[model samples]
Each structure stands twice: as C-alpha cells, then as structure tokens.
Target: MRSIPSHHRLILAVLAGACLALASPAIGQEAEDGLEIGDAPAIMPVDPSDAGEIERGARPSSSTGDANRLDRGERDSAPPVTKGDKPMVGGEPDALQGINIYLRMGTPLPDVPPEKPYEGEPDTAYGAFQRGLFLTAVDRALPRAQLGDPAAQTLLAEIMSRGLGVKRDLKGAAFWYGQAAQGGDPAAMFKYALLLMEGKEVPQDREKADDYMRRAADAGNASAQFNWAQILVAGTPGVRGLTAAMPYYEKAAEQGIADAQYALAQVYSALKDVPAEKKARAREWMTRAARAGFDTAQLDMGLWLVNGYNGPRDYEAGYRWLSIAAARGNVVAQNRLAHLYINALGTAPDPIEAAKWYVLSRRAGLKDPGLEDFYLGLTEEQQKQAIDRANRFRRT
Candidate 1:
C-alpha cells in the first residue's frame, strides 16, 4: 500500500473541528405547558460561513491520532470552534437572523399537580400563546401577568418581541422578559440573554447578558448550556477551559445538542489524559453527531474509523463517512476521500476517483501538494474523466 502524506492529519483535524462546531444552542424543555416548542421558530438560520473563534485547547494533537494510521499521519482533534449570529452592537446585525426562536419556549402551566383531578378549565391562554394566538394569548395572559405570573409575563414578551398580534414593541418585550427572568423562568432567561446581546431592542448589556445566559443554563435551558459552554471555552482556551465547559456540554449533549456531542467526541478520543470513561463514550457521541447531519462529525468519524483511534479500523465505514462529508462540500473530507481511493483502503484503487475528489477540494481552496503531484501524473484521458466527475459533483 502506498503511504499517505503526514500533513493530511492537520488538514483533516481542522476540517472536522469546523464541522463539529455547527449547531444551535438548546432551548428550554420542548414540552412546557403541556406542548412541544421546538427550537423557538426558525427566524432563519445564520449563514454557516461565519466561523466563531478557535478554541485554545491545551490538548495536544490526537493520541497518535490521524486520519489514517496515526503512526504515519499523526492527526489530532482540531481546536473546537463555534458559529452564531453574533450581531455586535456596532456591526451589521442579522436582524432577521434567529430573532424569533426565543418565542418558541413554553413553560409548565402548573407547578404542582392538582391534589385530585379537580375539574378545572384547561389553561387555553398558555396554549394559545404557544400556538401563535397572540391576541387571545395577550388578552388571557395580561391578567395573570398583572398578577405576577412568570409564564404569563414571558408570553407577553414573546408576543411583543414579534408583534405577533400587536405592533412590534421590542422595548416592551424586554420589560416583560426582564420580569419573567427575574421571576426565575428559564425560557425568559434564555430569550432575555439573546436580546441583551443583540442590543437592538433594548440597551446592549453584555454583563447582564452573560449573567442571564448562565442563569438559563443553570435552569436547564439546553441552548443556554451550549452557549454558556462557548463562553467558558472562549474565556479560557485549552484543557482547563474544556474541562470546565464539560459539565455544560454534557448537559447540552444529553439534551440532543449535536455541537456538544461533537465537542465531547473530540475531547474524549483526540485529546490526551482524559478519563477512560470519557474516551469510552467518544465513538458513541461521534456517531450521534454524524447521524444528525453534522458534516464535520462525519469527517471525524471517517478518520477515527480508518485510523482506529478509539477502536479497530474499519476502512469501509471510514469510506462511507468520508463520502458523506465530501458530498456535503467538506473540503477536507474531499481530500481524505481521494486518499482513500488511492490507497484502496475500502474500495478498489481508482486513480480517476482519487483525482475527482482532489479536484473538488482544490476548487474549494484546499491546496494539497501531494494530491497535485498525483493529479499531474494522471493520463490526459483519466484527468478529463476526473474533471468531468468533479464538475458534476454538487453538495447534497
């Protein structure tokens, strides 16, 4: 078998980390008020191109970890990165970016179960509130809001923020959110934190925003936990920071946060000196994140399987995952996939296939000299076929 180049580990680690960072923070429990509120609403997804800061992970490169056979490749986990619609107070804001997601939060209508099935009217107001019946929700919730109901106050805030039934009143929504947040409502705390950061609806207050974000995280808001971990990671880059961020990441991951899952996999398998238990779970978490359509996770998964980082090598599985990420436009995956073909690690060696992947990755700005050499050696007819395949490829 032809030996693979060493630099690929660095390139692939970077590629995997970028994919692992994608995802939205957690929201409060989906079933609050006896209803499911999925991820607020999609005000719209922020462009995935806006990459967040690099995690200053103290962890060394993967444990002899590489995309394939660490002894030769020496790959490690890429530094954790994050992505978000961080609309700085001064910079152009993604006003429509993820604005309405907070409004999807729903809180439990009843704190205590009725002693008996005491026949009581169903709380339709909160129901209406979650159902986007803003006018009726406002009408019904106003009284309770006046009476100091935290959930009611939150409902009013959601309505005002979007001007769902009434005029958009950001300031007014901010006030109600403040009240509900102070009342210890997790939903309100999460929304308020985002608003504080955005600063367009109300005065920008980062200190307050951080405080509220932490509060929501503490109160089991999944989104808050993920973002809060981001804050902690940013504050202290390296192993200590990742260690500190673990608890929140764990919480968020359990709640099905794909980013957290990907992060956990990186720390457990690719980093050095972690507890055995954590490392044991790395493959499982990576699988979950990969299945969730996380392109980076897919890349990492391909590498891990082929390199046998956490377990025995499985070239076919590695090929499968690399193909998935490559199809999704992951440049690093495209490059590694080319290597897979040349080595015949899974499929039969096909120089044309190898050239095809190399062409795609090169087009996306990844310059691999080894691949270039290989591409140059191809016969003109083979190069034309490779180019034809590359040109025909599109992100799935």
Candidate 2:
C-alpha cells in the first residue's frame, strides 16, 4: 500500500495494454490484411490513468454531465480519422498493437479477474467493486471480512490499498492481506509477501515473504510461481537452486508467463548439467517468449533462428522478429537488424534500411565501427533516405 511511483503507474498502464494486446497472437494473425508492413499502425502508449477509464468502459466526462455519458463499452461517437491516422486496411483490429516491452523482464501484470459468464448468483461485493461503487463494495464486504472470509478479506485489502472509497490505509490493508494469506488465499499470499518484501506498513521479513511466496506458487499463482522460481535460483548455492527452480519456472511458463519462459530458456541454455533434449526445450521456450512480444527474448530468438541453434535455420523469421523488436526500441535488435539487412541474410539487400537501423542503434549508444563504415559508404541520396527513416521511427 505504499504510494506507487509515477513510473510504476506508467508500467502498470503499459502492462494493461500489453495484456489486452498479447493475450493471444493467433487472434492477430486473423487481422493481418493485405496491407504493406509499412502501413501497419503503430501501437500508441496508453496513459496509466486512462487505462482505468478504459477498463471501466467509462465515457469522457463532459461539462454537460452524466446525461451525455454512455453505458459501459458504449461509444457516444465514432473517432474521426485525422490525416495521419493509421486505420486497419481490410481485416479485424490488430490485436498485437500496444504490446509492452517490460514483458521481456518478466514483470507480471496486476491480478484482475478475466471476463467469464456468471453462474447462479453473483457476489454483491464483487459486483459493486466491478461497477466502481467502491463504498458499496466495502460496505458489503466488511462484514464477511470481519467474519473471517478469506476472499472478502482479500477484497478489503485491495480496496484499502488502492484507497478506492476510503482513506489510504497501508497498515490496515497489509493486516487484511496477511489475514487472508493465513487463511490460504493464494492471491493474498502473493500480495502479503510483496508487502513484506517491500517493508511497506509491515516489518521486512525475507524468510516469511519466501514462505508466503512458496505457498502462493504451490497454490498456482503464476506471478508467485515465477517469483518463487527466481528466489530459488538466486538464493540456493550452485546448481541446487537452479534445479529446484525449474519446475516452478515451467509451471509459470505453461501459464503463458513470458518471464518464466525466458528464465527457463536461460536455464536450459546455461546449465551444463541439462540434457540435450532439455536444451532443445530451452529453444522452444525462448521462441514462445519471443512470440509473446518479449523484446529481449525476441533478440535471443532472432539470433537463434538465424544461427539454426537446436532447430532448422529460419532467417526470414529471425529478420521479422528482430525488426519487430527493433521497432519497439531494442538497441541490440536494431544493430542486428542492420547487420541482417546489410548482409541480405534474411531479407533482400537494402543498404538504406541497414544504414537507417545502424543510425538508430548508434543513437542508442551502441558503437559499431563496421556498421559505421557501411553506413558511410551509402550514396548521398540513400543516406538522406536512411536519415529520414530513422527520424520518422523516433518520432513515432
């Protein structure tokens, strides 16, 4: 319940969009029209605060007040396309738009309920919470929470921590989270463990935090599984922790956690004790993470594909993935993309494209004398075009 930093909030917003965008890549495949790749719309970053508004499906507030507002997910008017607006060419909306780069580092998004059909009866507290009636949710949940209902306790913790309809109460929130964790709520255990680790309104207790994290992981919390794997891998000596961490990492990875996938890839690649088959598993997991829009994983996967490591060589796939990562601001990917373009490895030779990527990589503080020489050898017109492209990429 510590005051969240602005950067954290921004990261949360990015993850919100990314979760929506990368939930399934197959969904995006259906939306790829015949439009040229250059015509693909750039993913615009959503403001973290505005993500809340989007989640609630609320309309923009107007001076005229509530009368003009629409219901959840209802639009009052269509957005007018401006001169520079990039509209979908001929298919469904691009689902991969707005993928966040933080997924590469394995940060999990905040736990939120996925959309599902309601069964018999809806929990009133949860219903009220969903509608943004925070006070009503608190009123409905307080009694149950007091009565030792673990779910209600967790709900109260979430509400209090966010100051949804009450004053911010870090201590109270932490207390409720701990209570819920003790009652065997996996989400609560994860939350409480984080608070314990951060020492926010609670005493720092790494041992207790580790315990809660393990419990949460055992209970199938994907974030907890990934975090516990990290703890095991980092805390245990030699190969013992790494060996112990593998199952948890696999569990999280199977649940579509990109960080876990990347971690597993690293383990399989680096662990000399791992069997050849397991090393092959590493390549598969790396591909999965890369396809999930993890930039670092994308870079590694691109290189792997190019080199045919543990698989058939696929230069085209490598080039495509590298270009995607480079466009998302990965310096390594940018440099690699330049190299690929210059050498015509996976793509048709395009010195201008290579020079443009080289310029972009150089601007990011990556020094490469070979790239510099190649870029300098370009014709003046080609150099101008590359410069223009580089500038355009930055502006977008």
In order of appearance, the predictions have TM-scores of 0.66, 0.67
Local accuracy of candidate 1 as per-residue lDDT tens digits, 270-389: 446778888799899999989988776798788889888687889999999989988988778889999999999988999999999999988877788999999999999999999999
lDDT of 2 by residue, 50-72 (tens): 21111112333532334322233
Each prediction's total of clashing residue pairs, residues at least 3 apart in sequence or on different chains, is 10, 0
lDDT of each: 0.68, 0.69
Candidate 1 ranges with C-alpha deviation above 4 Å:
1-122, 130-134, 160-172, 270-273
User: For model 1, what is the C-alpha lDDT against the true structure?
Assistant: 0.68
Root-mean-square deviation per candidate: 21.8, 15.2
Give the Å error, residue 221, model 2.
1.0
Clashes counted in candidate 2 amount to 0
Estimate the TM-score for candidate 1: 0.66
Residue pairs in clash, model 1? 19-296, 25-223, 26-222, 26-223, 27-223, 56-238, 58-238, 62-76, 65-75, 66-75
Count of clashing pairs, candidate 1: 10
For candidate 2, the per-residue lDDT at 196 reads 72
